[model samples]
Target: MTNTMWVRGVEWLAAAAADPRACKREWDHGEGVALLEAGRFWDVLSVPERLGLLTLDLLWRPGLPVPGPTLVDTAAGRVGFLLPPDPSGGWVGSGLRCASRGSWVAVPPPYRPARYLEWLVPPDGSGTLHGPGALEDALQQANGTLAVLAPLCGR
Candidate 1:
Protein backbone atom coordinates (compact mmCIF):
# COMPACT_ATOMS: atom_id res chain seq x y z
CA MET A 1 0.00 0.00 0.00
CA THR A 2 2.77 2.41 0.86
CA ASN A 3 4.69 1.46 -2.25
CA THR A 4 1.62 2.18 -4.30
CA MET A 5 1.36 5.70 -2.86
CA TRP A 6 5.01 6.38 -3.58
CA VAL A 7 4.64 5.22 -7.15
CA ARG A 8 1.54 7.30 -7.56
CA GLY A 9 3.24 10.33 -6.18
CA VAL A 10 6.16 9.78 -8.55
CA GLU A 11 3.82 9.45 -11.45
CA TRP A 12 2.08 12.66 -10.48
CA LEU A 13 5.36 14.50 -10.42
CA ALA A 14 6.23 13.24 -13.87
CA ALA A 15 2.91 14.35 -15.20
CA ALA A 16 3.26 17.74 -13.59
CA ALA A 17 6.69 18.23 -15.07
CA ALA A 18 5.53 17.50 -18.59
CA ASP A 19 2.53 19.80 -18.46
CA PRO A 20 2.67 23.38 -17.23
CA ARG A 21 -0.96 23.28 -16.25
CA ALA A 22 -0.39 20.12 -14.33
CA CYS A 23 2.61 21.66 -12.64
CA LYS A 24 0.56 24.62 -11.46
CA ARG A 25 -2.23 22.43 -10.25
CA GLU A 26 0.01 19.94 -8.46
CA TRP A 27 1.95 22.79 -6.96
CA ASP A 28 -1.27 23.76 -5.29
CA HIS A 29 -2.59 20.26 -4.76
CA GLY A 30 -1.04 17.20 -3.16
CA GLU A 31 2.52 18.55 -3.26
CA GLY A 32 1.41 21.93 -1.93
CA VAL A 33 -0.45 20.44 1.01
CA ALA A 34 2.44 18.17 1.81
CA LEU A 35 4.87 21.07 1.80
CA LEU A 36 2.62 23.34 3.82
CA GLU A 37 2.15 20.71 6.48
CA ALA A 38 5.86 19.96 6.64
CA GLY A 39 6.76 23.61 6.69
CA ARG A 40 4.71 24.49 9.74
CA PHE A 41 7.78 26.00 11.36
CA TRP A 42 8.02 28.68 8.69
CA ASP A 43 4.49 29.93 9.09
CA VAL A 44 5.77 33.12 10.57
CA LEU A 45 7.49 34.14 7.32
CA SER A 46 5.78 36.46 4.89
CA VAL A 47 4.35 35.07 1.65
CA PRO A 48 7.37 36.08 -0.42
CA GLU A 49 9.86 34.79 2.10
CA ARG A 50 7.94 31.56 2.11
CA LEU A 51 7.92 31.28 -1.67
CA GLY A 52 11.38 29.77 -1.74
CA LEU A 53 10.41 27.28 0.91
CA LEU A 54 7.24 26.38 -0.99
CA THR A 55 9.08 26.15 -4.30
CA LEU A 56 11.71 23.88 -2.83
CA ASP A 57 9.07 21.54 -1.44
CA LEU A 58 7.23 21.56 -4.75
CA LEU A 59 10.28 20.47 -6.67
CA TRP A 60 11.40 17.88 -4.15
CA ARG A 61 9.11 15.47 -2.37
CA PRO A 62 11.61 14.71 0.36
CA GLY A 63 12.04 10.92 0.38
CA LEU A 64 10.39 10.22 -2.96
CA PRO A 65 12.56 9.41 -5.97
CA VAL A 66 10.25 11.35 -8.27
CA PRO A 67 11.54 14.76 -7.23
CA GLY A 68 15.16 13.81 -6.65
CA PRO A 69 18.04 16.27 -6.55
CA THR A 70 16.06 19.47 -6.95
CA LEU A 71 17.75 22.85 -6.95
CA VAL A 72 16.24 25.44 -4.64
CA ASP A 73 16.53 29.22 -4.85
CA THR A 74 17.24 30.56 -1.39
CA ALA A 75 18.35 33.89 0.02
CA ALA A 76 21.82 32.38 0.23
CA GLY A 77 22.16 30.91 -3.28
CA ARG A 78 21.19 27.98 -5.38
CA VAL A 79 21.50 24.75 -3.43
CA GLY A 80 20.91 21.21 -4.57
CA PHE A 81 18.81 18.66 -2.75
CA LEU A 82 19.96 16.80 0.38
CA LEU A 83 18.23 14.44 2.77
CA PRO A 84 19.36 13.78 6.32
CA PRO A 85 20.48 10.26 7.11
CA ASP A 86 17.55 8.31 8.44
CA PRO A 87 18.23 7.03 11.95
CA SER A 88 16.84 3.71 10.75
CA GLY A 89 20.14 3.17 8.91
CA GLY A 90 19.47 4.38 5.35
CA TRP A 91 18.11 7.18 3.19
CA VAL A 92 14.57 8.15 3.96
CA GLY A 93 13.25 8.09 0.40
CA SER A 94 9.72 7.47 1.40
CA GLY A 95 7.24 10.37 1.51
CA LEU A 96 6.00 9.18 4.88
CA ARG A 97 9.47 9.17 6.42
CA CYS A 98 10.56 12.48 4.96
CA ALA A 99 7.38 14.27 5.99
CA SER A 100 7.65 12.77 9.45
CA ARG A 101 10.82 14.77 10.09
CA GLY A 102 9.85 18.31 9.12
CA SER A 103 12.57 20.12 11.03
CA TRP A 104 15.42 17.73 10.35
CA VAL A 105 19.03 18.90 10.08
CA ALA A 106 20.39 19.82 6.64
CA VAL A 107 23.94 19.74 5.33
CA PRO A 108 25.83 22.94 4.49
CA PRO A 109 23.37 24.32 6.98
CA PRO A 110 20.84 27.14 6.61
CA TYR A 111 20.66 30.63 8.03
CA ARG A 112 19.04 31.34 11.37
CA PRO A 113 15.22 31.11 11.69
CA ALA A 114 14.98 29.17 8.40
CA ARG A 115 16.01 25.71 9.49
CA TYR A 116 12.96 24.33 7.72
CA LEU A 117 14.75 24.78 4.40
CA GLU A 118 17.53 22.37 5.31
CA TRP A 119 16.25 19.51 3.17
CA LEU A 120 16.31 21.65 0.02
CA VAL A 121 18.89 19.63 -1.90
CA PRO A 122 22.11 17.70 -1.70
CA PRO A 123 25.51 19.44 -1.74
CA ASP A 124 26.83 17.78 -4.91
CA GLY A 125 24.65 19.78 -7.30
CA SER A 126 24.15 22.75 -5.03
CA GLY A 127 25.57 26.17 -5.79
CA THR A 128 26.81 28.52 -3.09
CA LEU A 129 25.09 27.75 0.19
CA HIS A 130 23.66 31.24 0.45
CA GLY A 131 25.68 33.28 -1.99
CA PRO A 132 23.53 35.02 -4.63
CA GLY A 133 21.20 34.39 -7.56
CA ALA A 134 19.65 31.36 -5.92
CA LEU A 135 16.25 31.55 -7.60
CA GLU A 136 17.70 31.56 -11.11
CA ASP A 137 19.94 28.66 -10.29
CA ALA A 138 16.97 26.80 -8.90
CA LEU A 139 15.15 26.97 -12.26
CA GLN A 140 18.03 25.20 -13.94
CA GLN A 141 18.33 22.74 -11.10
CA ALA A 142 14.63 21.97 -11.30
CA ASN A 143 14.88 21.13 -15.00
CA GLY A 144 17.84 18.87 -14.43
CA THR A 145 16.19 17.14 -11.50
CA LEU A 146 13.04 16.46 -13.48
CA ALA A 147 14.95 15.21 -16.48
CA VAL A 148 16.79 12.69 -14.35
CA LEU A 149 13.70 11.47 -12.53
CA ALA A 150 11.37 11.27 -15.55
CA PRO A 151 13.16 8.30 -17.04
CA LEU A 152 13.01 6.34 -13.84
CA CYS A 153 9.24 6.69 -13.73
CA GLY A 154 8.82 4.33 -16.69
CA ARG A 155 10.38 1.57 -14.68
Candidate 2:
Protein backbone atom coordinates (compact mmCIF):
# COMPACT_ATOMS: atom_id res chain seq x y z
CA MET A 1 0.00 0.00 0.00
CA THR A 2 1.13 3.56 -0.62
CA ASN A 3 1.98 5.96 2.17
CA THR A 4 -1.36 7.65 1.70
CA MET A 5 -3.15 4.34 2.08
CA TRP A 6 -1.08 3.46 5.11
CA VAL A 7 -1.92 6.72 6.84
CA ARG A 8 -5.57 6.34 5.88
CA GLY A 9 -5.63 2.78 7.15
CA VAL A 10 -4.19 3.86 10.48
CA GLU A 11 -6.69 6.68 10.66
CA TRP A 12 -9.50 4.23 10.06
CA LEU A 13 -8.20 2.07 12.85
CA ALA A 14 -7.89 5.11 15.12
CA ALA A 15 -11.46 6.07 14.32
CA ALA A 16 -12.65 2.59 15.05
CA ALA A 17 -10.88 2.82 18.38
CA ALA A 18 -12.95 5.88 19.15
CA ASP A 19 -16.30 4.14 18.77
CA PRO A 20 -16.89 1.98 21.82
CA ARG A 21 -19.62 0.06 20.05
CA ALA A 22 -18.24 -0.38 16.53
CA CYS A 23 -15.38 -2.41 15.08
CA LYS A 24 -14.59 -5.24 12.67
CA ARG A 25 -11.80 -7.53 11.48
CA GLU A 26 -11.85 -8.43 7.82
CA TRP A 27 -9.97 -10.94 5.71
CA ASP A 28 -9.88 -11.34 1.95
CA HIS A 29 -10.43 -15.01 1.17
CA GLY A 30 -9.62 -14.73 -2.53
CA GLU A 31 -13.32 -14.06 -2.96
CA GLY A 32 -14.78 -10.69 -2.10
CA VAL A 33 -14.02 -10.03 1.61
CA ALA A 34 -14.95 -11.27 5.03
CA LEU A 35 -15.62 -8.77 7.76
CA LEU A 36 -15.96 -9.71 11.42
CA GLU A 37 -17.23 -7.10 13.87
CA ALA A 38 -14.77 -6.59 16.71
CA GLY A 39 -17.20 -4.74 19.02
CA ARG A 40 -15.45 -2.68 21.74
CA PHE A 41 -12.00 -3.78 20.59
CA TRP A 42 -12.23 -1.34 17.70
CA ASP A 43 -12.71 1.59 20.01
CA VAL A 44 -9.97 0.69 22.46
CA LEU A 45 -7.49 3.42 21.42
CA SER A 46 -9.65 6.45 22.02
CA VAL A 47 -7.57 7.55 24.97
CA PRO A 48 -4.64 9.92 24.58
CA GLU A 49 -2.13 7.31 25.58
CA ARG A 50 -3.48 3.97 24.38
CA LEU A 51 -1.15 3.34 21.46
CA GLY A 52 -1.06 -0.19 20.04
CA LEU A 53 1.93 -2.48 20.44
CA LEU A 54 2.79 -4.64 17.49
CA THR A 55 4.83 -7.60 18.77
CA LEU A 56 7.18 -8.88 16.13
CA ASP A 57 8.96 -12.23 16.05
CA LEU A 58 12.55 -11.05 15.98
CA LEU A 59 13.88 -14.58 15.71
CA TRP A 60 13.08 -15.95 12.29
CA ARG A 61 14.73 -18.57 10.10
CA PRO A 62 15.28 -18.45 6.38
CA GLY A 63 12.38 -19.34 4.04
CA LEU A 64 9.62 -19.03 6.64
CA PRO A 65 7.17 -16.13 6.52
CA VAL A 66 6.05 -14.07 9.55
CA PRO A 67 2.35 -13.57 10.29
CA GLY A 68 1.51 -9.90 10.66
CA PRO A 69 -0.14 -6.58 11.54
CA THR A 70 -0.27 -7.64 15.18
CA LEU A 71 -2.92 -5.66 17.11
CA VAL A 72 -2.51 -4.88 20.79
CA ASP A 73 -3.98 -2.90 23.71
CA THR A 74 -2.68 0.10 25.65
CA ALA A 75 -2.82 1.42 29.22
CA ALA A 76 -4.78 4.65 28.73
CA GLY A 77 -7.98 3.15 27.42
CA ARG A 78 -6.61 2.94 23.89
CA VAL A 79 -5.07 0.48 21.43
CA GLY A 80 -2.12 0.27 19.06
CA PHE A 81 -0.70 -1.97 16.31
CA LEU A 82 2.76 -3.47 16.17
CA LEU A 83 4.89 -2.38 13.28
CA PRO A 84 5.77 -5.19 10.85
CA PRO A 85 8.94 -7.15 11.51
CA ASP A 86 12.10 -6.38 9.65
CA PRO A 87 12.27 -8.12 6.27
CA SER A 88 16.02 -8.62 6.37
CA GLY A 89 15.30 -10.18 9.78
CA GLY A 90 17.71 -10.39 12.69
CA TRP A 91 18.83 -13.59 14.40
CA VAL A 92 18.48 -14.50 18.08
CA GLY A 93 21.18 -17.17 17.94
CA SER A 94 22.25 -20.29 16.12
CA GLY A 95 19.87 -23.32 15.93
CA LEU A 96 16.98 -21.04 16.92
CA ARG A 97 13.78 -20.81 14.90
CA CYS A 98 14.15 -18.10 12.27
CA ALA A 99 11.90 -16.61 9.58
CA SER A 100 12.22 -15.51 6.00
CA ARG A 101 9.28 -13.14 6.16
CA GLY A 102 8.23 -11.86 9.56
CA SER A 103 5.17 -9.72 10.18
CA TRP A 104 4.26 -7.43 13.08
CA VAL A 105 2.87 -9.34 16.07
CA ALA A 106 0.57 -6.80 17.77
CA VAL A 107 0.33 -7.18 21.54
CA PRO A 108 -1.03 -4.59 24.06
CA PRO A 109 0.62 -1.78 26.10
CA PRO A 110 0.52 -2.86 29.70
CA TYR A 111 1.92 -5.87 27.79
CA ARG A 112 4.45 -4.27 25.57
CA PRO A 113 7.33 -2.09 27.18
CA ALA A 114 9.50 -5.17 27.47
CA ARG A 115 8.77 -6.94 24.18
CA TYR A 116 11.46 -5.01 22.32
CA LEU A 117 14.22 -7.05 23.94
CA GLU A 118 12.80 -9.94 25.91
CA TRP A 119 11.78 -11.70 22.70
CA LEU A 120 15.30 -13.06 22.47
CA VAL A 121 16.04 -13.73 26.13
CA PRO A 122 13.45 -14.72 28.70
CA PRO A 123 13.03 -12.70 31.88
CA ASP A 124 13.33 -15.78 34.09
CA GLY A 125 15.80 -17.47 31.78
CA SER A 126 14.03 -20.80 31.11
CA GLY A 127 12.27 -22.70 28.35
CA THR A 128 13.11 -23.24 24.66
CA LEU A 129 13.10 -19.38 24.31
CA HIS A 130 11.07 -19.29 21.12
CA GLY A 131 10.24 -15.89 19.61
CA PRO A 132 6.46 -16.33 19.75
CA GLY A 133 4.39 -19.12 21.19
CA ALA A 134 1.68 -19.86 23.78
CA LEU A 135 0.07 -17.34 26.12
CA GLU A 136 2.59 -18.14 28.82
CA ASP A 137 5.50 -17.15 26.59
CA ALA A 138 3.83 -13.94 25.46
CA LEU A 139 3.01 -12.94 29.00
CA GLN A 140 6.58 -13.49 30.08
CA GLN A 141 8.00 -11.46 27.19
CA ALA A 142 5.46 -8.66 27.42
CA ASN A 143 5.77 -8.30 31.17
CA GLY A 144 9.53 -8.31 30.99
CA THR A 145 9.57 -5.62 28.35
CA LEU A 146 7.07 -3.52 30.26
CA ALA A 147 9.15 -3.62 33.41
CA VAL A 148 11.95 -1.93 31.52
CA LEU A 149 10.07 0.53 29.31
CA ALA A 150 7.55 1.85 31.81
CA PRO A 151 10.13 3.94 33.64
CA LEU A 152 11.47 5.43 30.45
CA CYS A 153 8.07 6.38 29.07
CA GLY A 154 7.08 7.99 32.34
CA ARG A 155 9.96 10.41 32.07
Strongest candidate by lDDT:
1
lDDT of model 2 at position 39: 33
Per-residue lDDT over 1-155 for candidate 1, one digit per residue giving the tens place of the 0 to 100 score: 25554344334323313343554444345333122221221111112223344446554455633433333335544333333223342222212122222442122212111332433332222221222133335444644565577699772
TM-score of each: 0.21, 0.25
lDDT per residue for candidate 2 within 9-119, as digits (tens), equals 434433423231232222111222222223322211111121113123422325644322333223233322222233443324222222233222222111113223111
lDDT of each: 0.33, 0.29
Q: How accurate is candidate 1 locally (lDDT)?
A: 0.33
- For candidate 1, give the lDDT of residue 95: 22
Error of 1 at 5 (Å): 14
Clashes of each: 11, 21
The window of 10 residues in a row where model 2 has the poorest summed lDDT is 43-52
